[model samples]
Structure formats: C-alpha cells, structure tokens
Target: MPRDTPYLQVADEIRARVLAGEWAVGDKLPSRARFAEEYGVGQSVAQRAMERLIIEGILEGRAGSGTYVRKARERRRMIRSRIHREGGGSPFRSALKDQGSAGTWECNSRARIPATEDIAARLAIEPGDFCVMTHYEFLADGQPAQLATSWEPMAITGGTDVLLPEMGPRGKIGVVARMRSIGVEISTAIEMPRPARATREQANFLGISVGDLVTQLERIYFDSEGRPVETADIIVPDIRWEIAYEIEVDDSRF
Candidate 1:
C-alpha cells in the first residue's frame, strides 16, 4: 500500500545478519537515515522494517540512543503442536533437548484443587475434579531454565504414582519418558504461547524479576486413541528463550 511492498523481506535481511553473528546482540543498529541511503530506499521503508523487528522481539529501540539488537539467549528451535511431526516424539522433551543440555528435574504429583478454568477444561473431568497434578522444575547446566506443571484426570491415572505426595521423582526421570516405558504412546500435543507476568513463586523458580516478560507454553498430551492424558504448562523467561521457524521457498518456477 505504501510502496514498502516487501517490508518483511527487508526485515529478514537484518534478521539474517543478527542470526549470523555479524551483528552481536546489544549492538547499535545503523540509523534509519543511514539504512535508507544504503538500501537506496525511503526512510519509511527502513522504519517499517525496524518497527516490525522490534515487535517480534528481535530488536529494541532506546529513546536517546538507537535501535539495538536484543541480547541473544538460549532460543527454542522447535515447537510442534503434534508429537509425530518433529521427529515423532514428545514435543516438550524435544524442545528442551534442543535448547541446551537437559538438567535434572524434581518430579512429584499430588491431588490438587482445580483452581483455574483452563485447568478444569484441560483435565476434562469437571470443574472440581480431584486432579492429579505433576510438578517439575527443569534446569539446564545446573541453572533453572523452566518450571512446568502438568494436570491429569485422577480417574485415568488415579492409583498410579502420578498422584504420589513425594517431594519429587527420586530417580529424576522425565515423565514423558516414564510414560513410554508403560506402553502409553503420547500421540498428540497442543502448545499455546502467551505473554504472562511472573508470579512470586514463578519468579523465584525462574530466577528472574517479578515483572519480567515471560512466555508461557501450555501443552496438552493425548494418547494414540485420541484420549486426553496429560496437560503441561511451561513457563520460560522471555529474555532467556526464543522460538524459531524456518520455511523453505522454492523458486524453481522462476
């Protein structure tokens, strides 16, 4: 509409530079005037590109200074809604495996009150169901990376250790991996990304400020027969994690 026909293309050029390590994080980007001149384009085009990148959390703009590349952090390379798409495995485990070395988790389950509407729906057992809730605080390199809570219907996993009141999984094994040993193949998963404010407990668990930006991922796991099995909600510090998607463009016709 504004003759900035390919604004996303222009932004991709800058994003490639950032991702390639040519321009490190926190480095000041070229001024708008300079970029416009370099690309032989109007200032509006360059401005649009910068604005889009800022909105995508790739860059930051300061009032007195200039646009700066955001400090690169441990980025998430995978987020699959379906378990079999990304190598046919548990999406959450795949996501964590790619970001960094998997750290030990303290896993435990308890009979918890269904406090939120979302939880009630995910468990699919009614509003006040005695839910079997699993808690895990995952770490990477001995530092906290994320905290996750999973809820399941007590009717399905009622008498199992899924509702044990222990401190954690004493053996420190991933729940998904544990499920597989019991011949329950996790066949479906759904992930939702949301911007959330950190709670006091989440802040302490994540080692971040109470007001820091956080991206929360809610994943629902289902069995091969399409029955709901588990629902996991993961909290990741915004500054510490990123999600990337790569699409191939074929120009064979051209």
Candidate 2:
C-alpha cells in the first residue's frame, strides 16, 4: 500500500477479519495501543484507522468502553410519492385503467381487535375501540415488494360495501380511494418514516435475513372535517426500494 494510504489499508484488513469470521460479533477489538504495536504504527495512526471504519458504520465506539464491530450494515432504501385528489363523485373502478396490467391484492379477514394506545391516538378513536383490519401484500415482477395493514372503525365499515375486493384503486391501492367510494372524503395524509429491523415474519415474507434493516412507513388518512378515516402501516425491504424527495426553489427574489 502507498505510504499515505495506511489508514485505509488497516481498515481493509479489519473488514477482512470481520468477513472471514476471525472477529465475531460482540468481540472486543485489540486496544488502540495494542493495534499500534501490532501494525508498527503510532497510536494516533491506529486510532485514525479505527475512526474511519466507525464513520463508515462498520465499527461502533461506546463511551468509556473499547471500540467494537457493529451489527453488519444492511442495504435498504425508500421511495415516497404523494398524489392529490380532485372532484366530488367517486372515481371509477376503471381508475385502474391507467396503471396498466391490473395489480393483484391478496386479502385476509379476521375478528375485530382493540388498538394499542398509539394506534388509538392516531386513528382518533377510543383507546380500546375494536377495529377491522385489512392487510394487502403487493407484488411486482412476481416478487413480494410491499406489505400494508389498514385499520378501519368497526362501526363505520362493519357492514358496508367497503370490504369488497374491487373497492380500492389499482396498484397497491390506498385506503383513501376506498373511503371516497363510501362518501368519506379524505383531505389529509400523514406518513412517518423509520428505520427498523425486519421481524421474523417480515424476513420470511421478504426473503431476507432476519436482522436485515427495512423501512417502516406508517400513515394516517383523514376526512375533510378531520375525522380519522383510516390508518395503515407498511413495511418495505431495503434491497428493493428507496425513497426520494425533490426540493424546488424560485429564484425571482434572489
């Protein structure tokens, strides 16, 4: 390695040690002084090399404790898109007409259950109100890509045409369209972004490591008067999807 590139070389060596299973998870690394002695370098040089790996999210340093390897990094990304709805009457089932090749939605029905305190707060319902849960798994290119669960008020959607297979829009159709069909005008949408590790259930569904990191998107939709219409939680694996946002500025005042 070149003289000025020693830190990177040291980092590469440590990474190899990790991949080769020489240093396992939770294993403490050699002290900085020991590493410097082993590599025939100053303590400052070894410390710098360790710092580089830490910044890359490969190593973690605990305050007052020695540095150690972090849990392996997982590859995941998120893509969030927003759309605005117009007009009064409900959109046709043919709104599916434009998205091409009708997307398939797998559905299952179960008994009403009480919402957690957080869920109840978000849905604006009683703390223990029972809810009808609808889960939809979306697939594209014949691969499982997204999973979503929607919660609806048991009393409102309990006996309507809302449960029909053809009720929503096309391509992972959201709850907003379904509400519109039933005269519920959704005027606001809230989406929460978070990084999470895949649960065993998610790992099996997405065909990834159990510890892999994934994106969790929780959303709440509201009617025009601000009553909660629906709430949904979606899990997206990192290997396949990403979230992008754009900012536009008008330079007229500049």
Candidate 3:
C-alpha cells in the first residue's frame, strides 16, 4: 500500500464520521479550523480532507455558505457507440433512453464567428476563418447533465439549408443528417477524452464544485472525402456521470 499521508488519514476519519451519521444530508460540516482542532493537525490538512470529500460528492462548498453534506443521486450512465440511431438525436438522448429518463436541451447558435486556433486546427481551417458556433446545455430529468460547444466551418454550410444547426426548416436534425443534406457524407468521428477539473462557470452550470473532476472530449467529424466538417468540446461532470463505450467487433476475425 502507498504510504498514507496526513491528509488521507484525516480524510479517512472524516469520511467514517459522515458514514456513521454524524452529519445528515444538508448538515453543515465543521469549519476547517474546528476540524484541525479536533484532528490535532494543521488547518491545511483539514482543508485537504474536506476537499477530498467534496470531490467524492460527499460534501459541497457554496460561496458565502458553509460546506454541507450533499444529497446522493445515482450517477447517470452515458454510453458511446459506433452507431447513432437511424434518424437523429444526440448521444445524451441515447444515454437517457437506457436509463428511462427524459432528456431535453437548450441550444443557442451564432454564425460567422472566427475559429480560434484550437478549433481551426481541429477543423483544418485557418485561425480567424468564419464558423458557425453552437452552445448546448443538455438536461436529464430537467436537471443540467452536460455542456457542449460545437463549431462548423461556414465554408461548408454557407448559405445552405443547414446554416444554423437547430434553426432552419430541417434543423435540430443531427450533424450527420444536416451535413448529408448539403452533400457531405459523414464517414468518421474521432474523440479524445481526458480528465479535467471544472472551471467556476462550468461548476455553476453543472451544479458541481469548482475543481471537481470532469471528462472533456475533443471530438471532430470528417466527411467521406476526409475533410473535416465539425469539431466540438463536450464536458461531462465525473461525479454525475459514468462514461462507457460500446465497440463494434469485426466479424471476419473468426
């Protein structure tokens, strides 16, 4: 076993007390100074212990409000697969279907936004080139569940029926269908997932604490001609979600 540090030891005791019902849901926890006094450790050690519990979803810190025990909710499962259902819908919708939960979302879009250096690289466009940007806040059972920002090159959808992702006559249809309408057959989507700490704004949007862990996916879609069509950054809170993947196996190996 790794050497137990002061913070972990302190955290273990606090977690035990919480599990033993020393504090009920919504109960305000002792201040860091009080915890240090009781644990006979430095205040920093006590703070670290509380932070550990916060990250574990046991405790939450609110500005101008004391830390309190958080209510427990089942972490929703979000599954990614090689196939999207025949028509259109987001992966969040697919995940909600598995949980028997209703999913809805709010989307706001802007056209002719300059592609940033990062987005430009992902979309094979030069920085400062124009793109249509869409921001999405997906909800499960009416609570915020995920956040996504997508960028599509205007050079591809300019003056087309699919100019705005969720607005035109055939809008709200997914990227594949929208792109297909413009004669771009989506052939591949690549996603790279990495662990991240939530920012203040992100924490506020997802109802999580700043510094709480999350999964960030850098995703891009390419057409049959191997040209990039769209790129997006997807954010999912780790405490509220369990991310999984369904891989399709080739039958020829047998």
Candidate 4:
C-alpha cells in the first residue's frame, strides 16, 4: 500500500481524538499553529488536514471563528422508486409530499442546444444533435436539497409548448406523464448512481464545501419502443441526504 501523507496521518490522529470524545460536537478546536506545533508538522499541513475534515463533514470552519467539531445533522432519506402516480407531477415533489415537506424547484430551460457526447450517448443521439436542456435547483422546505440537469431531443418535442420542461399547459409534469401526453409512453427509467465530489458550483448551490461527497445519479427514460426520451443527472449531497430505493415485492409467486 502507498504510504499516507503527513497531513493525512495528522488528520487520522485528529479524527481518532474526535472519535474518542476528546472533542465533543460543536467544541472549538485549537488553532492551526497549536496543532502544527503539537503534530510536529508545518502549519500548512495542519490547515490542509482540517480542511479535509471539514470536507468530510467532521469539522466545520466558521468565518473569523475557530474550527469546531461539526454538529451532527439529521440526514433525510431521498427515495427513488416506481411510484405509481395517477395524475401528472414531478416525482421529486411527490417524494417530498410523502415526507410532509413542500418541495419546489427553480428551473431554466434552453432550446435547440447541441447535445454533448455524454448526453447523446444517454439519449442515443449523435453528438451535436439539437436538444432542449433544463437545469433544476430543487428545494425542500426552502433549503436547496437537490439539483438536476435534464435533456430531451428536439426531434421529440420540437415546436411544442412542452419543449420547455417547466412551461406550457402541462408543466412540472414528470417525464413519464409528459411523454404519455405526446403519444409516447415512457416504459422504463433506469438510474445509475455513483459517489462524486462536489464541484465549486455544486458546492455553492448545495451549501457544502468543494470536494464534499455527493451522489451523481444519471437517469434515462425510455419509451415503449425502446427509444430514449429524456435523460438527467440528479445531484444529491451526501452530507444531508441518504438515497433509498423502494421496492414493491409481489408475493403471488409464493
């Protein structure tokens, strides 16, 4: 195994102290100068270790205030499932409703933008094909909770009011209902999620530090004909939320 760096070793020691209850939650920690002297490392190394802990949600740095052991916050569960909704609505909103919280989103749409290679692969379109793209900032109880960037081929929704996801007669409806309205039935939605590090922009939006852990969830909707209709990258912050999948098991076979 590769040897750990000095700063990481220092961080491990600090984390061990914290875990051993030497520093309780919300307890202010010593200054970096003190830590540097105590650990026999450079002050910069101590700073980096503290920053790493901050990014890991173990410590919190307040502006002009000393770093402190982070207070534990309750992480809410974000459920993804084949929820059967009778009418049209975003599944995200439905999910928040289930939790007794009001979920709202701010969205901006761009039409006729060329699909990037990644998006094209998800949509089964050639790169540079025109598509409609929308970026969503989802809020739960007025706090930014999730983010998504959705793409749809213009060939599928061109010239329709629904071209913009959050506009027209049936706006804010989910891909399944929206596609059904346009004569295309969305048959399946497949999602793949992996751990990711937050970018500067995502960190700012989600009120987390850069390099904080997040979940990059890529979901694509397929029509009954097996043609891709829409694709989106759903960003969920790991510090504040946990992902859950609801599986409805049928016992008739048993």
- In model 1, the worst 10-residue window by lDDT is 165-174
Give the clashing residue pairs of candidate 2, or none: 76-238, 77-242, 78-242, 78-243, 79-242, 79-243
Instruction: Write one digit per residue (lDDT tens) for candidate 3, span 77-186.
Output: 78877677764365667667767988889999999999999899999999999999999998998988889999999999998989999887877767888898889999
Ten residues in sequence with the least summed lDDT for candidate 3: 86-95
- C-alpha root-mean-square deviation, each candidate: 11.4, 13.0, 5.7, 3.9
lDDT (Cα, tens digit) per residue for candidate 2, span 136-174: 776654556677787877766667767542343322345
- List the candidates' TM-scores in order: 0.56, 0.57, 0.76, 0.77
Give the CA lDDT, 0 to 100, for residue 13 in model 2. Answer: 79
Ranking by TM-score: 4, 3, 2, 1
lDDT per residue for candidate 1 within 1-254, as digits (tens), equals: 12235655677788888898887888899998887887777889889888867855688999999999996543544443333343424344555566565545666766755636777777565777777677888776677778888777766655555344233352234445445555667665667789898888988787665566788888777778877777878888776666543334569966
Residue pairs with backbone overlap in model 4:
none
* TM-score, cand. 1: 0.56
Position 77, candidate 2: lDDT: 34
Q: At residue 89, give the lDDT of candidate 3.
A: 67
Model 2 vs. true fold: TM: 0.57
